[model samples]
Target: CEQVTIIIIIINPGFVLVHFDISPASTDDPDIKQMMAGSTLRKVKSHSWKKHRHFRLLEDGLTIWYKSRWAGRGHSTFSVSDLETVRDGHQSELLLSLSEEFPSDQCFTLVFHGRRGTLDLVADTPEEAKCWVDGLRKLIHKSQTMDCKERLDQWVRDWFTKADKNKDGQMTFKEAKTLLKMMNVEMNEENALHLFTVCNLSLCVLEQHTSASLMSPLLSRDEVWKVFQDFSADGERLLVDELENFLQIEQGEREGRAQELIELYEPSEAARQQMCMSLEGFQLYLCSPHGSIFNPDHEQLHQDMKLPLSHYFISSSHNTYLTGDQLRGQSSTEAYIQALKRGCRCVELDCWDGPDGEPIVYHGHTLTSKILFRDVISTLKEYAFKTSVFPVILSLENHCGLEQQTVMAQHLKKILGEILQTSLINGQVPEQLPSPQDLRGKMLLKGKKLGGLEQRSDETITDEVSDDEDGEMERESVEDLTKDTADSNKQSKLSRELSDLVLYCKSVPFHGFEPARASGKCYEMSSFSESKVKKLTKDGKGSEMVQYNVKQLTRVYPSGMRTDSSNYNPQEMWANGCQLVALNFQTAGLEMDLNDGLFRQNGGCGFVLKPEFMRKTDSEFSPERPESRPGYRPLRLSIQVLSGQQFPKVNQKEGSIVDPLVRVELYGVPKDQSRDETSYINNNGFNPAWNETLNFVVHVPDLALVRFVVEDYDKASRNDFIGQFTLPFTSLQPGYRHVHLLSKDGTPIPHASVFVNVSISELT
Candidate 1:
């Protein structure tokens, strides 16, 4: 068991390898001294009896090579074993191979951490992290002699060109470079060259394949998924509409339909594209949900339109014939003025006797503590507190009896003073009835006051005399509107009578609008000349409708619907307040024959105050006008009617077709009924045996939000919904704003009448 080893030692830094015989004498040889600093070493070409490497050392550097130099010295092979600094630098990886199979270390990946390096992956699944480093290392080695950018460009051109995807002139460098970068890296010529030379070359050598598939294409490793959360709806999946409503191209709307949307709100093109649609657009979007397939308007478009909660008026419950229940309670003075403050153009007040003989503005004949006549005056006085109010209330009113009538005048004199003489100048719901006796008493008084006793005799005599006088005037002129110059001698006498009656009647002093007081004296009666009487009688068909025996027609028809349009005398009918009348047209709407403005040019104010309504405003009731500096607009009292069909749900079953625009007015007589009932019949002919005083009616569309406004010449007096309602319209159908008709209480026992006639203007 003898072993002999040769060991050699050199005292120099230059590359060398020496050997000396090692037997029992050299058994203590150690490598520590050789590795120690300041150790001396000599260069030699080979070492005997070692591993496959022949170790070499020289001035350039140290290295190891394999050789059979012991038998044949000429056959020595060397491989750079290590290179350390400028001495090595990037040549580090090449020289630092750990084994003779270093070039085949494709399975081992190098990750550089500065001067030191770590072995990341070894022969397992692909180590993306390591590949980045390996690629970079190979890139650095390949470009060892060039500048950073120059080396990259050269490497890219060399590899990225031939690496063309279609073998076309165009190269897929971005894609290839992208993949090279995915391993914690990026693409450049250096990376590209590294990919082409190292990763690409190694795989080819190992797999022994040369085909187009050998190219490894990759994109940069990006942590986009970790950084960004994608909230967009997945394509072709069910996303809740509310959660993510993305509109489609058409969304069922015609191309131009969107233009309409632009007009209402600001809709931009981008918004339109994003399904940020308009209200109409929403309708189009939900058209399927609504199933209103036939709606040519908006309904056919947006399928999902949904309405808010429902609404109705408080007064919808009451259905009366005349809608008279609209006037139940007297408004507070504050309420009245408040109404005026809010732009009520006119107001109505019923005059009843106060404790004294003075007439007071009150609705009921008898007053209770809660309801007093003073309230009306009080409200008016307060109303005057405001200024420059427009369209002040010209009053429209009813008197219960001569007593109430006198009281009405007295109250007007008290509150309005001269305005009452000026404005008829002037002026929700509950249901109740007035006593029959009160009604009867009022009627007896009206009939007597409208008597024909004294005038009957005078009229008869004048009629006889005018026959002869006209014969003379026939040769002269039709000058004195009321005369007849028949015989030369009779003309003088007839002319005198005519002058004494008709001309004077226009100035009849203090016509009785108030309760007939006569200062408790019997009111005087005067006679009129028949020629004069007949001249102003209102039947003259030329320019004005002459008042005639329309009572017969009214009695028979009981409605304004006279089938014969030719016989309809509008001027006379309205002048005399005849209830029965006719219109040539049946249907009404925007197409209705309306002559507007105060006269008949625009849309006309339909009805005029009846003679009875103004009869009390004769010279006797005239008082001194208010002394305020400025004047008021001739008070505008525009009474409008909102039809039943317009009331929310009430017209549903009836299939109501109505204009959204409201039309202002008092209750209108429907176009059909007998003559007798015409005067008092409710528009629909409810309560045909009617007396407007006994039963008045008002029609409100809805109790909710119903606002009944009334003002005086100075614009005063406002009331409210009786108990509850938040709407502009409320219906207590068949009840009047009773103050406009009967006394404070509705009983017509002591009846009164207000005659109103309407004539639509037709330009000849």
Candidate 2:
């Protein structure tokens, strides 16, 4: 059976039909090309759970199919684009655990994007592992470099392969109609036949006019022509007037830009001469950066990075070492790498004393696993600036003894070297904190400092203050270093080496707003639990909290009671002008969605400059009274939930189609927060059209975040999440736009999107 299967794969005519020459000839490496031949490898889920599986790369060069012998002919597949990277050798803990059984050179791991689990594999030979690793790297690069149009084309091709159940090159009219329904198009028979006839005629004309060699690839051009015909009145040519209408109505471009676009994107000289666009030109324009839903102007480092760090909302993570719940989670250096890669500027590390005089990081007195503090520091040094060049803040929750603390400090200094910010910039402490631009590529320690910078190095200072001053320790089951009793006031000796490393982000206890205002220490920051911050905000001290945050930085963290490692809504903290509002990065939900949305702007540099009103100390801009704030203006936001395309199946059971619905949510000032959803479209996940208009009156557009959520409607149970996309209202581009949907973990879902028309106008 195995020999027959190999022969079939080698000589199959269907392989040629499925293969697309998307990768350039120059990039066709021998190793990658060899991946078309299948191999057998051991898939390792754990030390005791390893089984042989047949693995093969498809002819498309973008997908991998794998199946176990026990599964018979059934197989599972994943796209190369889904992978974040390929790690050679025993880089992952799972691969490293099998070191005794498998040589390091024979193992590799495929790390996927978002929250997907890593795939660990052990090949029969070292050369086989290298072939897989190097081939995957080249394929990943090709996937990442594809433009918008290329990705869409690949997505369409993938769907076609799935629809071709017979594995034949041709599809009957009945098969084409079924494919349309599976793609979420609910057209009547008459209209569907008419459209299918038009497409068939378009392909026939292309095959007749072009050479035999070009006929095989004409299907892609036919798809583009179909889209062109939808917008063009003549169905053969797109004039400048029609192009202008598309730009204005579909692309949300202002009037009179059609001629410029034609000059810029038109590939044919005839189309350029006529001041119009062809089918190819239209596809090029759609693939351009300007055609994206995100404003292209904000795609780079467009924001002012010279502002003080406190004047910006920083992306942050709490319990950065944990991959799961705080109590029993596994702590690994990979957590730090993941956080930094996602542009988390501030990461919390709970350091406790470990064996061999090394400090370990984990939730203290819990079942959670521990990782060496030095390893976390080394990981940070490598990945801190990989995604963003902005400075990173190590929010250390130090509970280590003096001996291990010194070791921790030594490891940080030695491993990080020049990356650590051990002294004031320019050898002077300024009245205001330095900007992210000034501290680029630097890492600051956010923990207790022994004393003032003038204090003698030999002097011993008692670190008596607790950053978690709200008695969070008493709420959780985990034991705290300082229990809630007379012993709660007990102090630990500070290590001079560690204390000196805390320069810019010296951790201090918050007494009151008056004391913070009087001290005026821009470098001294405080950490407050979510409960305490909520109390302060609700007690009419919201204005003072904002004013205090404008000078001295304030960090808000979740309550210790949330042992599940859940997150508080960071927006509430942001509303109060909090700088470092940390949340559990390991958790995925609405809070994390909001966090990703807010930081998805300003080039995702981990810092977004606060609005002018939030930064001004005397502006009296309380989130509780947004209407009375300076420069306050109410805006009417209208969004027409038009349609969705290629929505993935929420339930993968056979013939299980989703009843999809679209929900538009507004998150901001309390009164401005609301949600409106369209009625569900029955048995249609592919191309559901709502065309329902939802209007919102945003009182604070600068702080408001608009979230579009699609769910599979269920009458008997809660709706299951399908996909969503969220962005700040300020970043939203008006006019007709396609909102590319993301999985729950915030990774892009290929070709899954919602088309909507947006308009925002000031409300009188």
Error of 2 at 127 (Å): 3.4
**How good is model 2 by TM-score?**
0.87
Which lDDT tens digits does candidate 2 get at residues 619-693? 598887888876789999999877777798876654578889999999997867899999999987876778899
**Model number with the top TM-score:** 2
What tens-digit string does per-residue lDDT give for candidate 1 at 661-762? Answer: 111222211211011112211212101112222112222111011122111111132321111111111112111111111111111111111111111111
RMSD of each: 45.5, 5.6
Q: TM-score, each model?
A: 0.20, 0.87
**In angstroms, how far off is 726's CA in candidate 2?**
0.7
Q: Show how many residue pairs clash in every candidate, following the order shown.
A: 154, 1
lDDT to native, each model = 0.23, 0.78
Superposing every Cα of model 2 onto the true structure, what RMSD results? 5.6
